[model samples]
Target: MPGPLLRPLPILFLTRPEAASARFAEQCGDSGLRFDTVISPLFRIEATGPLPDASAAGGLIFTSANGVAVWLAQGGRRDLPVYTVGDATARAAEAAGMRAHSAGGAADDLIDWLIAHTPDLPLMHLHGRHTRGDVAERLTKAGLTCGSAVIYDQPAQPLSAEARAALLGTTPVIVPVFSPRTGELLAQERAQAPLLVAAMSEAVVNALGPLHKRDLKVAARPESEAMREVVSDLLKRALAGDY
Candidate 1:
């Protein structure tokens, strides 16, 4: 007699923009996790105004990869030290020839690092329009003399038809949300399919606003590695017939 057959894990619905989604897919592959996936971005990053003058600034702050992309495209100076909120953004900055340092993750962590380092010189934060924490303001209040420039705009987008159909299916869908903004957008979609949310942080889980109560898990840390671990663990539990 053969052992009991195992059930396939739920499909993953990736809501990050094209580039980021591709990176996540690559990570899943590298981790040896296989699952059907749908790429549906809820926001589009668009370059905005001219790059701000950073010639006199002490260093640069980047909270998102989009901001780093915009700054690089605008031909900003790459010699200055680049402070980032996560490893991905730091990698982007380094690829553009900048000396980059990651604060692990989260704006508060970045602010704390800046305070401890005491760069003292004026720091310019290159960011998108839909940013959550005011890194510049927080740093300034701490006597760091930080300023910000909106170099990109994250225009809202909607779920694709394929995404909607997948979300309505009986099979559970694992949605990994990286930001509070993304979580809010997912909540508004009101997907009725069985869902297991992998939120990057507690703030992201809270941003879901009571969507599905029983199927949400927050990452151990506000980092991509932690998010991936949460996703992998949830997939294992789901395959084992454990909710």
Candidate 2:
């Protein structure tokens, strides 16, 4: 007699804006991680305010691809060297005709990289309204000239009906939270269904508060690849009846 086969758990990527969620979904598909994905963004990325002039900056800092997109849209200069928090942002900057260097991942890592490499450059950080870590402040305190400008805003949005249904459904839901703000938002929703969270860092997990203690898995590094690996492990566990 053959027992029933276990179904793959559904992955619910509650990331910001449509673009980021779509990118994650694409990555999941490309990784051959067999699972249904529901991309319901919980925030909208809107360009707010004008972009600052970067002609005088020795280098530029970007924490998110959203910042790169907004800066490019607002006619930012591409001649200056660009330093990014992760690979994605670095790619975005390069795509926009700028020389970009990736700091591996996380704002703290970016700060460290800047300190070590561009210690004397006048850097300007272009970021969203909601940002983690004080990149500019920390750099300035470290005797490096650093400034920041808000190029975009990620306004909070409610989850879609499909997302809500998926979250509360019988199938296990796997979520990868990239930022503390997004983690906090997911915590507020507090879906009672079975959930496995893949947080980018300890900060993100902390933002989720105490309710998701048991099911939360923090990535080894605060990078998309690390988070994806965590999600892949969770999916494997789910298919093996260990989730």
The most accurate candidate by lDDT is: 1
Those runs of model 2 whose alpha carbons end farther than 4 Å from true positions after fitting are: 1-9, 211-214
Flag regions of model 1 displaced more than 4 Å.
Answer: 1-9
Candidate 1 residue lDDT tens string, 112-208:
9899988957899988888888899998898888888999988889899999897877667888999888988888875677788899987898889
Model 2: colliding residue pairs: none
Q: Of the candidates shown, which would achieve the greatest TM-score relative to the real structure? A: 1
Q: How far is candidate 2 from the true structure (C-alpha RMSD, Å)?
A: 2.0
Model 2: weakest 10-residue lDDT segment is 6-15
Each candidate's lDDT (Cα)? 0.85, 0.81
How far in Å is the alpha carbon of 4 misplaced in model 2?
Answer: 3.3
Cα lDDT tens digits, model 2, 1-243, are: 999876756665555678677777788678776787787887888899877877668998898888889988888888888899899889988887899999887888888877877556698988889998999999999889999999899899988888888776767778888888898888888576578889888888788895442377889988888888888888776656566
